[model samples]
Target: MWDERVPVHVAGDFYDLDAFRTRPDVLRDFETAEVGDVTGRTLLHLQCHIGTDTLSWAHRGAARVVGLDFSAPAVEAARALAAGLGHGPERAAFVTGDVYDAAQSVPEASYDIVYTGLGALCWLPDIRRWAETAASLVAPGGFLYLAEFHPVTESLDDATGTRIVRDYFARDAQVWDEPGTYADPDAETVHNRSVQWQHTLGDVVSALAATGLHIEFLHEHDVSVFPRFENFEVRGGYHRFPDGHPRIPLIYSLKATKG
Candidate 1:
């Protein structure tokens, strides 16, 4: 499913590949402030789709950046984009492999920063395994950083995003065979089947803590990178509920470090 959507995402206005070529830094303001300076550091991005966010770190002065994704086409596009940005494989590399095997799949054994971007955790069924695997690649003194859509939003009504309509503690995978992609909903596509799991805030934090990664902080924000709810309006490049509406966490970021 992800393989087929790579082209759509690359060409669609959602990503705006052309504009990205000119001004490639797309890291959110809060993410940069939380992650701190990445200059001369090696960063590994897990589940990197099309490598925009991964490359954004590279653009911000990370000495080395590697992006790994399960989709072959996504990796290929990432490599091409890296080359276009004047970065060779040594400076910006991309690999095609499952994130669960990141320790073995990545070129280096570990990295100074292990990053997992938004809308990624929901795709994995075992949050514990993901934490252990991802943490294993965080070099000593390095940290694993995660920016995700808050799980609480999943339980709310899709339209109003106000009332809870689904079980928050549901453990079963949500299976769907929906048509079209998120970038271009009306786009012609075939591989639309997908499965997603829900992991609460505690589930993610506890899983990382179990791996002996000290929790630095967990920050929740009222804004989202995508228009998750019908009532969301654009604010500072993010989607937010109306000013008068009660605010709920739409996104959360975490930083966990090894001793």
Candidate 2:
């Protein structure tokens, strides 16, 4: 799955590797501020593609950081980027493995924080299993933090002007055969077949609750790290609905802790 998307992400300007390297603290302003302090803490990032965000956490004072991805090429590229950025193998490490099978390689309850970023959950088929694995990786009293694109935005059809084309509560597999990638809309690719699953807001909360993780906070916002649907306006670093647009959730963040 990720193997096909790695090149598209790296070469595209959306990730803005140059901007990230020059000013690494960009994302820290809005998304990671709620993560609190990670000084001397062990952090694990699931579906961490290319280690950009993982390295950012390490740069923010994490004692140790590990990034896991399903794509071998992504892992290799991430390691290479880390070495290039002077992170080396000591401060941060990258592993290639499925998010569902992450426990087979990493030990249980070994991390102080389990962090996942935007667009991570839709790639997954089972939210319950993903939450269970995430909960299992955190030590007692540790927390799990996630910032993801809201499912409400997923149901809208942006191509036709914010029409609610899909059901908001649908839990089904949606396949796309587009020729361009999100990162680079102009880049043409042959391996365009992609599979994704949509889970509702209730489904997400229930899945985490089932893992014995206590919900600390669940925040809904109109901002997104990236442009989600077409025709969406980007202002003040957030994506917003058009004038007099109906109320719809765009993004959400959840914080949970192991009891």
Which candidate wins on TM-score?
1
Q: lDDT tens string, model 2, 1-259? A: 4577787787668777777777555453556678988899999999998888898888888988899998899999888878777886677889889999898865444699999988899999999999998888988989999988888876778752367787887777899888777777677677888999998888888999998999999988866666565656877767665667665667788899987
Instruction: Kindly report which residue stretches of model 2 are placed more than 4 angstroms away from their true locations once superposed.
Output: 26-28, 107-109, 159-163, 242-244
Clash count, candidate 2: 0
lDDT of each: 0.95, 0.82
lDDT of 1 by residue, 140-169 (tens): 999999999999999999898989999999
Q: Using alpha carbons, what is the TM-score of model 1? A: 0.99
lDDT, residue 115, model 1: 98
Hey, what RMSD does candidate 1 come out at?
A: 0.7
Candidate 2 residue 62 Cα shift, in angstroms, is 1.0
Q: Look at candidate 2 and give me any clashing residue pairs.
A: none
Error of 1 at 140 (Å): 0.6
